[model samples]
Target: MSSENDWNEDLCGCMNDGGTCLYGFCCTPCLFGANAEKISEKNCCLMCCLYLVLGSVYLCWVPHYFERQKLREKYNLKSNPSCGDCPTTLLCSPCALCQEARELKARESVQRSALKANNNQPVVSQPEANSGEADHVNMRV
Candidate 1:
């Protein structure tokens, strides 16, 4: 192979000529062609993208599995992806929207409790009584 014919074994899997690989399209053939560098670069780029997506899925989503029991014990977090938008199963950050929603719900619950407490109280109409007395006094004047 020439110095410019550097091909990635992983990218193409096995390439016979200087063309694209039949098995692994991400790999470049390193046998001939002046565009060997470009082809190799393209192959490397494809491999990089593949690795990136795989890594993202594995690292981001897979970790939650490893900590499945622990998360469940701690936060009642389960690993069921079908558990309807819970943070433990989701790959996205839960502290953003989920936490915000939980906080908002808690706030609304507190407000509701406060409203219930206020409703339980007996409201006195001192202003109305005072206004009626003022009107009566004005009539006398």
Candidate 2:
């Protein structure tokens, strides 16, 4: 990991992005699902189902905590001393989800702008075609 980068926004800065804040506030499960999909690069439906199921038993924070860790690692963000991932996700899930979504959006914007500046091409993050499956073929002559 490289030097730690501060979060682009604060946890309670949901109002910064009204759309994301509304989604997270109105439909928490959906928000969690979307964030999980981006963070884990897994099936969106599967992640949504898992979040809904575990949320019933108050265990949704488990996966969310891991996702937060992943975000920290990817951005090389320092851990919050006052409120770690587990506590934040467990206690204030909506805020946490909103923060993660905002961070992802900001990162994507930065990437797109950089690409555009370098070349007049629009580059977007595409999902992996193989979905992590090994590509192999058996050839018999």
Using Cα atoms with residue i matched to residue i, what is each candidate's TM-score against the true structure?
A: 0.27, 0.81
Number of clashing pairs, model 2? 0
**lDDT per model vs. reference:** 0.35, 0.87
Which residue pairs collide in model 1, if any? 11-27, 12-27
TM-score of 1: 0.27
Writing each residue's lDDT as its tens digit, candidate 1 over 60-125 gives 223223333332333343233434333532443222222222333344577799999999999887
Candidate closest to the true structure, highest lDDT:
2
Per-residue lDDT over 1-141 for candidate 2, one digit per residue giving the tens place of the 0 to 100 score: 367889997999999999999999898888888987887787777877888899999998888888889988888887888998889989999999999999999998999899888896667897766733434322321
Give candidate 1 regions above 4 Å deviation.
Answer: 1-94, 127-141
Top model number, TM-score: 2
